[model samples]
Target: MTEFDILVVGEANPDLLLRGDVRPRFGQEEQLLTAADLVLGGSAAITAVGCATLGLRTALLAAVGDDFFGALVRDQLTTAGVRLMPYAAGGVPTGVTVILSEPDDRAMLTLPGTIAALRPQDVTDALIQSTRHVHVSALYLQPGLAGGLAEVFKRARSLGRTTSLDTNWDPSGAWASLDDILAHTDVFLPNAAELSAVTGAANPDTAAAQLVALGTTVVMKDGARGARAWWPDGEAAAPGRPVDVVDTTGAGDSFNAGFLAGRLGGHDLPESLRWATVAGSLSTRAAGGTAAQATRADLMP
Candidate 1:
């Protein structure tokens, strides 16, 4: 029996969000005109929080610095009801993101700090063997975690656990061994831009198909256009539901969470896309990363 329904392996950081911002011009300093909100965020941490919010038995495997920010990391996870694995590194300062958002949208500048120190060994056999699903984020960013990640995914696949990869936007296309990573990925969730960049394909469909050829299920997200899934049998697309947009920060994370939740509930591909799309859309109605993520009651079969 699986001890945990999901395990999220990745970074955890504190977020300094400044809303109602005046634009910051390059080479010119802009003064803050309003109060900023501080929140907790990190790819893996957000996903784990979303999973827990949706009532999954979730665990987080991450490394946090032994510092003030690390304390905040633990507090946030505790508040969200996520089980924390033993952390790896000590003394390194935890990661932080400075988000400057206008009333319409936001821009984030990140300090990777301790998040960059994550290694694959942080994911132990005890956690991997007991988890039914394992989700990883930003595969291309961290160097130390790459090799361990490779082994972790392979072991999870061998153990009959579903593995999901959220190949979040990689500006430099950092990670070299993407193909090897995808081989162990049962489901891949990437935005349209990421799909195209990762596969070097001309279009989303082509990119998704290319991913499928690499031996994994692909769920491609196209912001307002909605989401699409490509499998061996055929293709499925879900149109985005109309909703009032607020902040897009955590939209993708919520989508992944909802989609995984649906799949774990035995929904088919199309239904899973629909569920995820709705969850993502709802997330944009609020300001912070997790603001609009749905509860189990919010998502009904």
Candidate 2:
């Protein structure tokens, strides 16, 4: 048997969620009104937690420091049943994202310590060959790995393991250098905004068409309305699951987990999309991403 059902290679960090009037002011103004929480963050870490919750044998390979936050991250991952591998990196402190959150939206200030420390070489050929699937996230945040991810994906493909990418948002606005990676990527997961930005095709429909032409299955995550997926031959969609909103910190990452776990577990496209939408919607019921993540029982008919 394979050592892992899925291997997630990306950033791992913690999020400090601050609620209430989060609008910051200058001159060191003192402002407070609500609650604060420190929770497991990072796209890869959250997704791994979700996958494990859904009963996948998940493992995470990411860099972090030997600091308190890193220890917290490792502890949370362990508690969530995700196998943490090679957790420490030298020189940098562990990364953290301070999320100033409202129910529907949020702003984040990030300290990219070991977040940017993951390199392509860290994902060895042995690691790729040991897993049934490979999933990567937060592409723009890890330039070292982002620069060489296409090669890594190529290796994964060559070994017969499937691959996926959730590039997240490209902060530079350029949205360049992804065509090569997408060529080797079997599944391309992006939000509508990220889809539009990456493909520059005016709207989601056009962007999905453009990307499917590159031989990638585009799964566009549209909040509230739902998510849609397009393969080269056909298309499918799933409506959003309505829920009481809390924080939207890691909903997208959870959606990724739902879709991936569904498909890997042999569900069809429409069913997988249902898994994704439900997982995404339910995740917002808590302060941080993984707090309210869906379980396999929660996802069943």
Candidate 3:
């Protein structure tokens, strides 16, 4: 029997969010007019929390330093009911992200600490065999894992496990060397910009089509406008929910959680997209990614 409904393989970090209306200046300047919050972050962690909130038996496999920040990361995941299979990166400190939040969008400054230390070796074969589905997030942030990601997905597929990949923006902008992994992936979740970056297509529809042609389902997340999904059989678009946007920190990850949760529960693509849209839109009601996430009850009629 599968031990976990979803196994999330990626980074584990904390986000220190500073919410305000002012931008940074060149010279020395101090402008603090709003609030500050420390919350659970990292695409994998946030998605795991969102999956747990949706009543999935979610497990997180990631690296963190044996430090206070690591403890905070673990505590938050445990509080959200996600099982942790964390590896401690010796000597390296836990990763942390400084998020400068505006009304519609936010800029993040990340210090990739232990996250860079995560390797494919950290994901054990036993863990892969025991999970029904595997989800990898923030592909570029984890260099150690990125190098062998294709093999990892292939191994999961060989084990009869469903696999998903969410390649969050690559800082280096070299989106090559992903075709092997994309071919093995069952679901490919990318934001509009990431889709364009990965496919080199100016049009979002073309980008999605290109990924679908690779034998992977493409779910393109378009903020405010909504989400679109393309598979072999057909394609569908779900309109985004209108809400007072607070911070769009981990909305995409939240959307992944909802989408994957629905898929694992045997929901069709259209129904899954509806849950994904609502989960992502609701996540923006707070300052951080995991905050304001929808629970199972919230999705009920």
RMSD per candidate (Å) reads 1.8, 0.9, 1.1
TM for every model, in the order presented, reads 0.94, 0.98, 0.97
Total clashes for model 2: 0
Which sections of candidate 2 miss by over 4 Å? none
Q: Write the per-residue lDDT of candidate 2 for residues 142-213, one digit (tens) a residue.
A: 999999999999999999999999999887777885889999999999999999888877778888998898
lDDT of each: 0.82, 0.92, 0.90
Which ten residues in a row are the worst by lDDT in model 1? Answer: 169-178
lDDT of 3 at 212: 88
Which structure among the candidates has the greatest lDDT?
A: 2
Q: Rank the candidates by lDDT, best first.
A: 2, 3, 1
Off by over 4 Å in 3: none
Q: Which one wins on TM-score?
A: 2
Runs in model 1 deviating more than 4 A are 26-28, 103-105, 173-177
